[model samples]
Target: MIQLPLTPPGQTPLRVMTIAGSDSGGGAGIQADLRTFAMLGVHGLVAVTAVTVQNSMGVKGFHEIPLDVITGQIEAVASDIGVQAAKTGMLASSAIIGAVADTWRRQGMADTVPLVVDPVCASMHGDPLLHPSALDSLKSQLFPLATVVTPNLDEVRLLTGIDVVDSDTQRAAAHALHALGPKWALVKGGHLRASSQSPDLLFDGTDFFEFDTARIDTGHDHGAGDTLAAAIASALANGSTVPDAVAFGKRWVTECLRAAYPLGHGHGPVSALFRLNG
Candidate 1:
């Protein structure tokens, strides 16, 4: 059994952790998560599962972190700093996913912690981030443990084998994903074809809620998913309900995308931290 550290001095800050890959370009993955946590007034911790060679243009390759190293990071942080809520993104293989699931159960976090699972399958430029063979493990081992599962249209199709092109399909996909285990399912409709509004569908096995924002015309959204998931986890750590957390995350990410500036020659990252100009 893993024993967590007691809260040490002063007013205890909300604590959140991100278990994900490292994006070298600083646009997505752990980088986006940390930025969002700080922006939302949470202390962020990370356990990197892989390192990707990526830029604004694309992901060239990746190297998975050793399982021992991954477990060590998670154990070190969980035992000492502790976590109120956590989020997972871009587990590159079944090995990493299984390790994470085992670690969570071992630490007694599976049922108690608020865990947001972002089913990140690929990069913005069509590079695969997760191994195809790991899909079963993700669905069987990790999905059942998630407090909420966030999947974009592409991921919805990938995970559920349903092409999510319209509202009806989106709802069906959300239900299908919900059946796999999460207490709530949020299907992000950002890439829906010919849609004027980007609508995200949230279903908590009983009720359905839709959150929509005007589709901003921009290509500088390299780390949007990571930012959204991190923001939701941050909100959860700060004691928001699932619906409220999703709403806050959506609003924050929309603003970040709106204020995004070109950083690289190719597509740039959304501004997780907006500028404070006079």
Candidate 2:
């Protein structure tokens, strides 16, 4: 847990950093994270990992940011402006993942600051964002440093090899992911389409907390995963407990879904325009 100043240095809002890729679509990745942070009253900082050519239709392709530049961005923000919490998105390759993990560890933020790992394997349109060879690196290096790992069903299967079809299996998946070393595991059930209301389960080794919400019928949920993870990271920056942060995030993203609107011919993004009220 991070203890943040109500008014950080230079009298700015509590700062939360998103060490993620840029979504030219303005739907997910660093774009969605910055929106979530701003709406939640925290200043958002970026350490862009990749520049993805993507939109409502799908991810066409991407260009990875150099490892040195990625590390430099992280250091530039952490050493100067500082961060109350941080989260990771599309790390395109094994080298990038290694760079981020090593930089974070060397900065001594692996334990001190709150870290949210959104194991983004693919886009909503079924496009692979991470390199196949980097999956092991993601698991081995990043997971152990995460304060909370937010993985959807697809990611859950990719990481833990568990098919989360029901509540029990969600629990099993949570346990499996927690074993990878994150202090908390959040298994999002937003991918479970058959259920009218599938609750996201959060496990902290011994106990389990489920955040149940009625399903909103909409296909414009392209950035829902990123939105949820960013909301958690933002709340952590705001000094919320892990359970409370997850709770707030669940509510926040549900509204984002409720406010979702269509953009392109295919699936659109959940609106981050659903700002938090004073």
lDDT of each: 0.89, 0.89
- List ranges where model 2 is wrong by over 4 Å: 1-10, 276-278
* lDDT of candidate model 1 versus the reference: 0.89
Which ten-residue region of model 1 has the weakest summed lDDT?
1-10
Model 2 has an lDDT value of 0.89
Candidate 1: deviation at residue 248, Å? 0.6
Q: C-alpha displacement of 16 in model 2, angstroms? A: 0.4
Model 2: how large is the Cα RMSD against the reference?
2.9
Candidate 1 lDDT, tens digit per residue, 1-278? 11112244576777899999999999999999998787666788999999999888899999999999998998999999899999999999999999999999999988778999998999988899999999999999999999999998888988999999889999999999999999999999888875799899999999999999998889898889998999889888777899988988898888889877797789888886673331
| Residue pairs clashing, model 2 | none
For residue 143, model 1's alpha carbon misses the true position, in angstroms, by 0.3
Q: How close is candidate 2 to the true structure, as a TM-score?
A: 0.95
Expressed as tens digits, the lDDT of each residue in 1-278 for candidate 2 is: 12223454577788889989899899899998888777676889899999999878899999998889999999998999888899999998999999999999998898789999999999988899999899899999999999999999999999999999888888899999999999999999987865779589999999999999999999888788888899899888777899999998899899889888898788888887855432
